[model samples]
Target: MNTQPATRPAFQDRHILVTGAASGIGAAVARQLLAQGARVSAVDLDETGLQRLHAQAPHRAASSRLEDASGHLWTARLDVRDSAQVEQVVAKAQAALGPLDGLASVAGILEMGEVVDLDDAQWQHCFDVNATGVFHVCRAVARRLRERRAGAIVTVSSNAAATPRAGMAAYAASKAAVTQFSRCLGLELAPYGIRVNIVSPGSTDTAMQQAMWAQGSSRAAVIQGDPSRWRLGIPLDKIATPEEIAAAVLFLLSDQASHITLHDLRVDGGATLDQG
Candidate 1:
């Protein structure tokens, strides 16, 4: 492994696992890593989406379940909500791609509801995937990285975690929980030289965000203040692209962020304001 910075591409020969990778930000992260010469294990609950990603990524693995000739891409269907499954897949990925250099915990579900109307199933499921699911992936990856004593982790979060939102109690609370959880994990792993950070994105152009628009909301509604709900507009006057968020995640995972940990990088186009 030629780790000499100038001799190889950034992430060359590195094994990185990205969850929720079948679409949106996770997919972007996986694709970029493959282009950078990394062996990427992309996992998600969307099997069909995984198939599409396996076929569309830069290295485009010849085998859906295995690495390509360059050993640069692998895809799997993962239900991060299942702890046992999360553990199994993490181990399987490491076995197939060698020790993992880091993790991109992007698996999450979006929930939208007013507190009065929210039900147990919605709230529970929201927390289950958004918060506990992140815990399962991070803990599993952290255990392995702890042994190696070197790695980086970037957990995808959202601006809702820091800022308040109308009709988003469950979603906001769940994200906030994971944000603090990552910070705690970062503190505990610091002694082992493992860096853990969070990427909190605002409104991004993705299927999930598009879903909101599909329900009679317009992109302009997202960019302009929805004062009725108290949702602020994006100061940048544009929605972020998945690639933009992935760029932030990669920066935190790369050596460029070697000295940064327990940090939360916001990619929300200033929707939450700098105070968030």
Candidate 2:
């Protein structure tokens, strides 16, 4: 409800591809991009959430909308685990919205369990979505950006990737892979004038965080530490909204961070004490 539009609409006519755009951090990024005048190719595994996002059109002029769109918004049902599907989607999105100005790789999953208790399928699923999925999309888009010789990318990771979490081994490990991968990618793409950065967020108020509550964790416990599980609470005494995380992401993608690359920005409200 506090989704404030930016005072300056700086990205007019720019194209951006947002994964996990159906909800949470991804959804927040998509809305703000539209508000800043970017054309967004919003893809997610959830078709319904995409439809709902398509209905919110105040960010842009109504006349800019297509028959199935709400101005500067294009929706696609994407499962990033499929490399082939990722390639096709990126191609079609560019054809529809023009060359991509940037990308926000926010599609990811969280599966918590101790290392020894983690099943093969569970471990693989986490890496598939959180790590390999990022690889697929980034490769698809980077190939284009390399030739065009410009653009930026921001991959969403988790703060747990920097700090240890007793029951989040799978999720944390996958996000760690994402963090390092983005750094390596930034290095390789630097000469081409493309920027790649990572945004690692702590506890945030979203359906994903609510699901942890459904599993019996209390909000107070999340904000006040959980020693038994080796989890640190937010020092700020509150959970972040997806929009806050999105702001960090957009900054890195914007010209404001033009000189920054291969950096991992933590938006954890001091939860990890600035851990790497």
Candidate 3:
């Protein structure tokens, strides 16, 4: 006789942390989380971007009048590559915003070049942000979540992690490392009632993707397979908006995915030819 609504906002009152919250997918994720009534701690190295994001949240105007006053949103400047800083910022966020209910690790950098052409700095920078940075955030947050025995973590990787792409050696390799690391972390955290998952996106319509386009026609070229580079065209015939990827990230972090962990959900529009 209890026929309640089958669905409702899944993130109400939850405190979630999102990295790379300045622009692209990270910004989109923060915005969506705020709209869903979640308390969001938006973290990024770009303090300006973080400020803009905080100002743009839907409840910003009403927050000043609310008595609880802690506001559902906060911003922090964090460089995930530094383990000490990661730990410090995460701890600070918990202190200010309360215990974290979820984490979305979207901070990453893309360095393009053939392996032979890549220098030590370029290679290390790629792993530093894309792989090692993820490790720092995950490790810091996982310890606390493990003790609490609850929470979810989602890492945004790339389709290139699975499909080989010319001129993307370092980026691909680093993503691959995070992909496996997330799976292993998931396995370890499963017993503690925590979930860890990966979202692999392809050719999303963000500034980072636009920068890769050298010519006006580059967008079309991306839609049409480039045999010379061994890249396949998107079967969906369109680049995903940042919000599309954010939706998947939110789902994995919600109770709806309670039974899901160690899963890599591809948001790549079949760009990898369904490669597992």
- Using TM-score as the measure, the top candidate is 1
| Residues 34-142 of candidate 3: C-alpha lDDT, one tens digit per residue | 8888988889998778777766777664442211224788778899999999999998888878899889999999898888999999999999999999999999999
State model 2's lDDT: 0.90
> Superposing all C-alpha atoms, what RMSD in Å does each candidate have to the true structure?
3.0, 4.2, 3.0
User: Judged by lDDT relative to the true structure, which candidate is superior, 1 or 2?
Assistant: 2
- Candidate number that wins on TM-score, 1 or 3: 1
* Candidate 2: residue 128 lDDT (0-100): 98
True-structure RMSD for candidate 2: 4.2
Q: What's the TM-score of each model vs. the native?
A: 0.95, 0.93, 0.93
Per-residue lDDT of model 1, residues 166-228, tens digit only: 878899899999999999999999999999999999999999999878877878999997888
lDDT of 3: 0.89
Minimum summed lDDT over a 10-residue window in model 1 is located at 61-70
RMSD of 3: 3.0
Q: Tens digits of per-residue lDDT for model 2 on 1-276? A: 779875767778889999999899999999999888899999999988887778774544444332234468888889999999999999989877889889999999989778899999999999999999999999999999999999999999989898988888999999999999999999999999999999999999999899988888978989999888777888899999999999999999998999999999999899999977
